[model samples]
Target: MSSLPADISLDTLTPEAVAKTIDHALLRPDMTVDEVVEGCRLCARYKTASVCVRPCDVRVAAGELKGTGVAVGTVIGFPHGSSPASVKVCEALAAIDDGAEELDMVLNIGRLKSGRTGEVRSEISQVVRAAKERLPGCCVKVILECSLLTDDEKVAACRAAEDAGADYVKTSTGFSSGGATLADLRLMRASTDPATTRVKASGGIRTLDYLVECLQAGADRIGASATAAIVDDLRARKASAPSA
Candidate 1:
């Protein structure tokens, strides 16, 4: 994880900083083109890290976000990580073709739980290879779906991702039964080498307070549909703080 700036603190957080840490999510299945466009506009306006859209929406999102400094990212296996490795690789390449600069791919939860760590690692490596081969510097985040794993499983998953050359180890898919928790975040952070693989907190991070807490707990990036609410709340707090 990139170290937080030495001088920055939650009490002095800036809206821009907070926004940059967010991957404003637009992955809901029911969202239409118009809504996706609007969400892309919001992401550009907030200057978020990216707009994580469904794979099919990548083209539109990429077009809308072009030159806006917000990247277009998409999911691979999605809420579930059961797709065959070849299929996941195909999905990753297709998303890249559609202009996605980042890929969040789900790792096989069942395989991991069954002690198939080698297979899990190899699958992630294949996706990572495909992504970088298509577009150099493409970021790959491996979703562990931490809620479904025990502590040992989570650590093993993190190691697999790291060994596979993934850029980040993500906590959850948000569509899952549970979301990111402080304990999980801390464990994920501790499991990976911070200089190599960063941790992302997704799922149920709706408020500015909780977002900040995640940051403190070791989240380098956050995925949330509540981008506006969180950023607006930060702005409001900054506005109301007495001038130094």
Candidate 2:
């Protein structure tokens, strides 16, 4: 994350700013290549931070968004994090080779729930290592799937992510029972070093108002498929706001 001036306020955030904070989700398994193309176009048109797609779509997304400034991102462990650490590492490596600039890897929820903190941290670290090894500039966001965890577990997950050298700690997988909430975002933000590990709110953030709330709560990015609605509403609000 680039450094912004200290006085920056959410109320004054522009469409460009909002777009830059979004990772336009295109990860549904049923999505076709044509749909992925269209989604990439929308991300490029909006100049979003990236187009978060499934691992197999990394190359296509990268090709579509080439030279557009928007990046190509894909999930590592994905909706479920039960994959072996080696598998996650291989996925990260393949993703980077396929032109992914960012990787959102899911934490092993069952292991985490079982108090296997070392294994969880080790797995995250391994994937982070694989990503950074293949593409030194690639960013990794470790998804905690917060809705299924207690507040204490959430904090623990944030710490584990930070310890694992992840660039960010994300709130949810969107496949879980619930998605990101302002409270979870705030807790994540508070748990990690903001300068090093930023917060990404994912899953249920489909509205302009909810996006604003996430930002206010210190989320640096929003993972959503409802990109059009959020961007449209932001533009309309900006257009109607009283002039200074």
Candidate 3:
């Protein structure tokens, strides 16, 4: 993890601040509609940054979160990035039409590993273009699936995503062998220009301590299923703090 400045203190963090960093995940393949609705309610209660659901659940999530101050997001070419760019673009457009404000798209991992950086960048660009054209200010996050890549490939993937004009470069899909790591988060933060692209640490971030560490390591956002637990814990801690 990247070292924080000596003056920095996570102990002063607020629950609202922590809640805003989370993209409450509702992407489990077996999740029922009722569960998705409940998850959307959870997001609204906590005021999370977004609720990231499956493609088919975009409209459901959107309807539930409408006017709740929480955005609706969905994945494209999800766990696998083998789909053609055209397909990903179409999926992104449909997601936008369904009221999704954020699109987390998996870049073609195989192509990146195969040394086809141009192809990878091109595909990401296409999705970004299609999404932005459909909905201005729609955020796009490119998932790197870091556990499957070497440090070099991860760096290349970050650069490719940034070059393609993605808003964030995320760590994984949670279906992979591993999730976000402190080292990976630090490396990703270092690889991207902070002004244009931010880092999102996803996969296996189920606790507040680990989430704070990811933030210190330069993650601007978090993707997790434990949003309520994490935020509630932070709120409890703040409430219990001794009076100055």
- The residue-by-residue lDDT of candidate 3 on 1-244, one tens digit each, is 2123433345757788888889999999999999999999999999999999999999999899989999999999999889999999999999999999999999999999999999999999999999999999999999999999999999999999999999999999999899999999999999999889999999999999999888888888999999999998888887888988
By TM-score rank, best first, the candidates go: 1, 3, 2
Instruction: Note the residue pairs that clash in candidate 2.
Output: none
RMSD in Å for all candidates:
1.0, 1.4, 2.6
Off by over 4 Å in 2: 1-10
Best by TM-score: 1
RMSD of 3: 2.6
The TM-scores of all predictions, comma-separated, are 0.98, 0.96, 0.96
Per-residue lDDT of model 1, residues 1-244, tens digit only: 4535544566767888899999999988999999999999999999999999999999999999899999999999998999999999999999999899999999999999999999999999999998999999999999999989999999999999999999999999999899999999999999999889999999999999999889889999999999999999989988898998
- The C-alpha stretches of model 3 lying farther than 4 A from their native spots are 1-8
lDDT of 2 by residue, 190-227 (tens): 99998799999998888888888888888888999999
Candidate 3 backbone collisions, by pair: none
Model 1 poorest 10 in a row by lDDT: 1-10
Which 10-residue window of candidate 3 scores lowest in summed lDDT? Answer: 1-10
lDDT of 3 at 34: 100
